[model samples]
Target: MAQAADAEGTVVVTTTAEGGRAGARALATAVRDQLPADRPGVVAVGAESGGGAVIVIAVNTAARTAGQDASTLVKHLLHGRGGGSPELAQGGGLPTGQLADTLAAVPGMFTAG
Candidate 1:
């Protein structure tokens, strides 16, 4: 069975069923769905600089993210793209490399919205 991790915007399930892309696509969709857009004042707040790709999570535009600098965290959570802020965060890239490490980290992070 492909095991999908339970990160806020991801689902990491172990499986060679479809060469992995299937699960990865599922994760992207989940991320887009979970991103909060109609939450009223519950805005994300922040800023990031540089010329890397970005993954924007529609939450707020704050100055910091989960724990790291908005920009850095954005790079860390790529899904083919990357970007961030306290109110809004973005991440995207090949879910390979540190993908396992990222998925492993999901358990320690906040799960339910």
Candidate 2:
């Protein structure tokens, strides 16, 4: 897995799996549960597989206080490609090799949004 953490408490993680969507989902969930909760921020996680790619965005309580909604922001960023609740969202079928670039852009997402 590749992970990046920002000063704002946002984290972006990427991984590759042989199982595709299922594997991506599992990893995203695991990472979300492992993130620190001292501050609110976005957890932007992704996984790429033979079939396609998966992106999941999760948020903590502090993020809410900052008016940051990971799900909504992700959907907007991906042009309405994903689906999820206010706190969590998932999108996939991105072009192969796009996960890394996308994850790298996540840090700027909060401030830009």
Candidate 3:
């Protein structure tokens, strides 16, 4: 798993999984569920699929307070198509190699957005 704190002090947690969409979403949900309720956080889980990868994200209430939208983040940063509520989102058709790098860059992207 990878963890970083965004400019707003929202913890961003990310990880990779072997399974596809279902697996990534499951892992993301697991990680998001583990975060303390009082803390602001985001969880991202990526998994390889076909020749690319899919990313799943979950945002907590505290994180949403800053107007964090997982769907928008993935679509903008990864150039992939996806949609979900501000609290949960998933996107796919991204370069598999870029998964980690993109996840790592998430915190910094928050500032730019």
Candidate 4:
């Protein structure tokens, strides 16, 4: 797993895990669970399979309060299709090479809370 934080204290984490969509979701949830209670964050978990990747984005409450939407982020950053509430979202069919870059850009997608 890799992590980055912005000036606003929003953390972004990226990880390549095993399982497919289920694994990605579990990883994202785990990352979110590990964050400090006061810190806002986003977790992007990707699993590579066949020729592409599956991604799951998990947003903590503080991050969601700061206007971060996992569903929108997955759609915009991964160029994939999926849906979920603002706090958690899952998507797939992303270019494997794009996963890192997409996760790296996550911190910048938030608005100040």
Candidate 5:
């Protein structure tokens, strides 16, 4: 797994997998504990499959408090690539490394200054 903090104070966490159910809540909890109390963020866990990759995302506290609807935000980020609720969402068919970049960029949408 890898983590990064952006200039807008959005925290991002990412993990890559070959094939398996990457628990969304577990990762979210772990990542949340490491995040700043005032930051909004997302954890994207991905798996390689067939000809593409699948990315699952979990939205964090900052986003909920910022009036950013997690589900909506994720859908926008995935761009019709996948679907899920605010607490857990998934998308597929992205290039190998695209999902990580997607997760890293999501926080800016909610925390942009």
Candidate 6:
């Protein structure tokens, strides 16, 4: 199991790539632009297995408020990677753990697009 925790309250999101490399950093920058100017966010490069990237993202204060679990949220982002390509991945940590570490394992999630 991996670890991914935010500051008290933060929005965490993950995404798995279909091929090539991790795209978390790029996605993070994109997502950041869409968020409120006052909010802080962080994106981490997860892992890469079977040709896809797992991008993990954390939103400040809003994501947690919407009943989102770091683990599940990150998992959701890696839903597809070819029929059972596997690479059974994880996003969140042991509830109150480090979120970045977990995401770092997910392929190219941390690459610069």
Give the top-scoring candidate (TM-score): 3
* lDDT digits (tens) for residues 56-89 of candidate 4: 8898888888787889988877665877879889
Query: What C-alpha lDDT, on a 0 to 100 scale, does residue 26 get in candidate 5?
Result: 55
User: Candidate 1, TM-score vs. the true structure?
Assistant: 0.28
Flag regions of model 5 displaced more than 4 Å. 21-29, 97-113
Per-candidate TM equals 0.28, 0.76, 0.86, 0.81, 0.65, 0.32
lDDT of 2 by residue, 1-113 (tens): 66556745555444454456776666666766776776665666677655566777777666767677767877876778887877778888777678778777777765544
Query: Which candidate has the top score in lDDT?
Result: 3
Model 5: per-residue Cα lDDT over 81-113, one tens digit each: 567776567776777667567666654664647
Enumerate residue pairs that collide in model 2.
40-62, 40-63
What are the per-residue Cα lDDT tens digits for candidate 3 across 32-106? 888877778888888998889888889888778877788887777667588787888988878988888877777
Task: Please give, for residues 1-113, the per-residue lDDT of candidate 6 as tens digits.
Answer: 32333433343334433232335434544554555544333333444534333444444334334443334435554443211112112332222233344454433432345
Q: Provide the global lDDT of candidate 5 against the true structure.
A: 0.63
Clashing pairs in 4: none
Off by over 4 Å in 4: 110-113
Model 3, runs deviating above 4 Å: 4-7
C-alpha lDDT of residue 101 in model 4: 74
Better of 4 and 6 by TM-score: 4
Root-mean-square deviation per candidate:
10.3, 2.6, 2.0, 2.7, 3.3, 13.7
Candidate 1: stretches off by over 4 Å:
1-27, 30-82, 85-88, 92-95, 111-113
